[model samples]
Target chain A: AQSVAQPEDQVNVAEGNPLTVKCTYSVSGNPYLFWYVQYPNRGLQFLLKYITGDNLVKGSYGFEAEFNKSQTSFHLKKPSALVSDSALYFCAVRAFSITGGGNKLTFGTGTQLKVEL
Target chain B: GAGVSQSPSNKVTEKGKDVELRCDPISGHTALYWYRQSLGQGLEFLIYFQGNSAPDKSGLPSDRFSAERTGGSVSTLTIQRTQQEDSAVYLCASSSSAGTYYEQYFGPGTRLTVT
Candidate 1:
């Protein structure tokens, strides 16, 4: 069984400040981590993913995530937050299943990001 | 190109009724998935289909919940005798199942409200 956790329900940041949304995961095999953002009443938009590359992965909307194998964490980060960045963010994990089960993502509860100007 | 899409953005139904949610995956994408989001339970995987065959029905909550896909293009999730607890935002996503990186694109989701 694989799972993900977003400890914070909400994160508030001032404009132009750096922001981070924490995520942690547990998987039997190698963890394939991903980050997605959802605007109000909109579907989730893929942000970035960490498969088997550099620890730091860049993504859309000037967002990035650092995958730390030792910590089992993939935290979403942005150098400078913009008010438009305020939205709901989710972290998900996918693990290789020998069962041949189609890749199904296990997602976290989601963290609400609020950027104030 | 167009992204994944779901029909009936919002739905309201009474307890004991049945509801169907639809999803159209991206063209030529062989994989489709269903999920649910609610206040109590974040996002949950409901099922996964590959070329109209479901190898994983593991995430389905109960027997009352069922889903099927046809023509390898569209899918419909059905919930029978819906309970209030069943009310949630139903999300659909699809991936090409190709390459080393498999990222699923999502649809807006259908919000179901059971009374």
Candidate 2:
């Protein structure tokens, strides 16, 4: 079984300030982590993913996330927040049981980010 | 190319009625997925399709829920005997390949309301 937890329901940040949205996971094997963002009346957009190699992964819209194996966490981050970044963020995980991406993906409850100008 | 698309962006049906939601994945994407988002359940994987075949349907909530993909292009999710608990946004996503690192592009979801 695989699951992800986004402890924070909402995170408010001022423009130009750094922001972080924390996520943690539990999986039967090595995990594949992903971050997706959703805007009003829109589908989730892929942000970034942590497959292997570097612990820090950069994604779309200047967003980045760090994969901490020891902490069992993958937290999304941005050096400077923008009002446009306000949206619902979800963290997902997939157990590396297969080489195919068709494996089921377990998602967190989601975190709402409100970036103020 | 266009991204994934869904028809009937919003649907309202009386309890016990059946409803069908359609999804058109991105062109040439071989892997398609269905997920449900609701206030109570949050987000959950419903099923996955690789081309026209569905290797696993265990994620589906119950017998009332079923899906089919044809021609490796479009897919439809059917819900029978809808209940208020069935109200949620149904999302569809597709990926170019089944590779572990492949990203699943999503489509704007269908908002289902059971009255």
Candidate 3:
């Protein structure tokens, strides 16, 4: 079994300030991590993923995530936050399983990001 | 190109009733998935279909929930004897294949309300 955890239910930040949303995972095999953002009444939008290679991976909407093998974590980061960045974020993980659907993503509860101007 | 789509954006039904939700994956997609999202909760895996391989139904919460994909493009999820606890958003997603490391594009989802 594979799972992910986003410890914070909500995180608040001031405009133009750097922001981070933490995520951790537990997987038996090699892991594939992903980040997604959801606006009000909208579906989850793919942000970025960490399959392999550089620890730091860039994604959509001025967001990035650092995959730390030792820490077993993938934390999303943004150099400068904007008010429009406020939304619900989810962290998901998948391991190499033979069942189907690319080993069905297991998602965290989600984090609500609030950016104030 | 159009993305994955679901029908009956919103539905309300009473207890003991059966309902069906639909999904249309992107053209040529070979993998389709169903997940459930309750209010303020994370997505819960439901079922998965990949090409002609047998579906993975391990994540389904109960036998009352069932799904089928025909012609490898469209899928439908059916809930029997709906209960209030069954109310939630049913989301559909699709990927090019059941290969590891492929991104899954999601649909808008169908909100189901059981009274």
Candidate 4:
């Protein structure tokens, strides 16, 4: 089974300061990790994904994530937080092989990121 | 036309009433998915349709919940005898295909409030 874990329920950071939202996963095979952000009354927006490449992956809105195989983690990061960046972040993982079943994503509980001025 | 669209942005219905939500995927998207976001559950995948086939339906909570996609473009999710617990934001997403490299685009979501 493929599963994701977001340890933090909420994270608060001051505007212009760097922020990090933690995420980890467990999968049977190679993992395809993804990060998505959702604002109030809106849909989840794709941030970035890590398939098989460099350890660090950059995404939209000045966001990035680091993929650590040993730690089994893919934490989202932003060099400088913006007040408008406040939203709910979700981490998802899917296994590469679909022999057991189909390719279905397992999402984490989600972390609420609050960027204050 | 530009992005995935869902109908009935906000729906408030009495308990035990049946409600149907619609989703219009991107013009050429071959894959569509439905998810529910509740206060307690966070985000849960409900169903997924790839082209004319749905290989997975394990995420659906109960038999009362059913969904179907036609012509590989439009989808409808129907809930029978809706319960208070069913109240949540139902989101729809579409991707180019059921591939690891494809990115899923989301819709605004229909907020279903069972009162």
- CA shift of A16, model 2, Å: 0.9
Which lDDT tens digits does candidate 4 get at residues A9-33?
A: 9999999999999999999878899
Number of clashing residue pairs in every model? 0, 1, 0, 0
DockQ, candidate 3, vs. native dimer: 0.71
Screening candidate 1 with a backbone cut-off below 3 angstroms (N, C-alpha, C), the clashing residue pairs are none
Question: In lDDT terms, how accurate is model 4?
Answer: 0.91
DockQ for all candidate structures vs. native: 0.67, 0.71, 0.71, 0.71
lDDT of 3 by residue, B1-115 (tens): 9999998899999999999999999999999999999988789999999999899998899999999999988999999999999999999999998777887889999999999
Candidate 2 lDDT by residue in tens digits, A14-74: 9999999999999877888999999988999999999999999999999999999999999
- Candidate 4, residues B2-85, lDDT tens digits: the string is 899999999999999999999999899998889999995778989998876644688899999999888778999999999999
Interface C-alpha RMSD after superposing true interface residues, each candidate, one decimal = 2.1, 1.6, 1.3, 1.2
Quote the lDDT for A86 in model 3.
97
Q: Which stretches of candidate 1 lie above 4 Å from their native place?
A: B98-100
lDDT of 1 by residue, A1-117 (tens): 888999999999999999999999999888889999999999999999999879999999899999999999999999999999999999999887666552788899999999999
Q: Is the docking of candidate 2 incorrect, acceptable, medium or high quality?
A: medium
Share of the reference A-B contacts seen in candidate 4: 0.59
